[model samples]
Target: MRRLLAGLISLFCFTSSTYAAEVSVALAANFSAPMQKIAAAFEQDTGHKAVLSTGATGKFYAQIRHGAPFQLLLAADQTTPERLEREGLAVAGTRFTYAIGQLVLWSTEPGLVDAEGAVLRSERFTRIALADPKLAPYGAAALETLDKLGLRQQLQSKFVQGENIAQTYQFVASGNAPLGFVALSQVFADGRIREGSAWIVPAELHSPLLQDAVILKAGADNPAALALADYLRGEKARSIMQSYGYGF
Candidate 1:
């Protein structure tokens, strides 16, 4: 009886392993938290694993152009995916908007940033952190907001640029900068800003941040890649995104 049970268990494990595969994905830094959670859930539900690499969309674009083995891309803006598709680096008709991101004016120090975002006008802080606008959608949005407020020229001198939004958040969190702009998803948790003070930058201040996802040509024949792409559009993934303050 013991031998029979052992045999059955081994067979089950073999079958599961035979059907499982890994999908390599390049993800936007701002979506790291939710995507991690979603990847775990996706693996649990589908028996496939997601191998994630997070960074600025522009960097990922450059890497993809250089033949990076990443099978999928979750970008910070629709333009990158669209451009990839146009360049024939990704599969056509597979691109879709996965989320709409929001920007925040954040400070690790409580009450340092007001709800109206009037802190940008103050000269109290010596340095302000933001991602490089050329590489990050969040950074571009930050510039647009500053421009609309007519503070771009005045505040440009205090800028401390990060390579990506994740690093930009780190700069402020580590006290390198007293305050700066970041993605709402970074500081958001439990239906509110997790710590410190933040003003959710109104969407009207800049162009809409439509984050898109696509399957790269390298993944065109990969079943795991297709599964992951479809899984991202499913209910479980949508719920995870919503928890992170992402919009559909």
Candidate 2:
């Protein structure tokens, strides 16, 4: 009886492992930190693994268009996912807003940026890092904020563009640029700034950054991909997103 029971248990374990699915996900650069935690929880709870690829949203969109074989997409802006849905690249009626991101002007040095963001007018710094406007929504928002402050043309010569928001954060954090526009989540932790100084850019300065997610057509028959999409909308994932300073 003991030997028979051991054989049954081993067969069950082997079957479960063999059937577990792995979903490929294309993620936005700004969502990296929180997605890591969420993906881990997903695997633990559902036994489905998520493989992530992070980069600028625009670049991801281009890759998806060129047959990138990704099963899911988490974009930095709503427009990209909406376009994919309209273009039939994504599954119909599966797109939804996952988070709203806040922009911040940050510097590695303490006291470099004030609450009012007066440092922009002072011209005390030589280089200001921003993501490439054409490829990153955060970079476009940075430009809009500068234009609102009437400093776009004046700061143009000093601007340094990065490939994505992650790279933009690295530029400032590494002191390559004294200051840069980045997602607040990148520098925030446990309800406060992680390090350095930051000026929280008011939402009125730019259009709302409503991030959206969608399951791709390639994942239409993938149960794991569908499960991941549903999991992202559940309370556990929502709590994790909130911890990262993302808004609903």
Candidate 3:
């Protein structure tokens, strides 16, 4: 009886492992932190793994166009996914908004940035970091904010551009630049700033950041990919996103 029970347990373990799936995902740089947690939870709950690669959405779009093998895309803006649908690179009707992101002007040093963000006019810092506007939605929003404040041209000379929002945050965190515009999720958690000082850029200052996710054509028949899409829309995933300061 003991030998028979051991055989049955081993067979069940093998069967479960055989059915577990892994889906490759392309994630926006800004959503990396929360997505990591979501991916873990997804595997635990569904017995499927999510393999994540994070980067600028625009770059991912170009890569997808050029035949990158990603099965899913979580973009920083809605337009990219919409475009993919138009271009027939993504599966039709699989797109949906997962989060609305906020932007912030942040510095590693405390008290350098005022509540009203008046530090932009003071010329106190020699350099400021931002992502490439052409490649990153957060970078474009940063430019829009400066333009709204009528400081774009004046601040352009002090600009240090990063490849993506993650790099932008790293610039401020490492003191390569005293401060920079970054995704609020990078510096915020649990309804407050996690570290350093930040002035949350108001939504009215720039266009709304409607982030969306979609399954790619390559994943149209992939069960794991489809499952992950459904998972992102579930309450558990939204709670994780909320903790990271993302809006539904």
Which digits, one per residue and each the tens of the lDDT, describe model 1 over residues 64-176? 99999999999999999999999999999999998999999999899999999988888789999999999999999999999999999999999999999999999999999
- Positional deviation of residue 46's Cα in model 1 after best superposition, in angstroms: 0.7
Clashes of 3: 0
lDDT value for model 2: 0.94
Clashing pairs in 2: none
Candidate 3 per-residue lDDT over residues 98-187, each given as its tens digit: 999999999988899888899999978999999999999999999999999999999999999999999999999999999999998999
Q: What is the lDDT of residue 155 in candidate 1?
A: 93
* Model 3: residues with Cα > 4 Å off, grouped in runs: none
CA lDDT of 205 in candidate 1? 96
Range of the 10 consecutive residues with the lowest summed lDDT in candidate 2: 12-21
Residue 228's C-alpha lDDT in candidate 2? 93
- Estimate the overall C-alpha local distance difference test score of candidate 1: 0.95
lDDT of 2 by residue, 113-216 (tens): 99999999996899999999899999999999999999999999999999999999999999999999999989988998898899999999999999999999
lDDT on C-alpha atoms for all candidate structures:
0.95, 0.94, 0.95
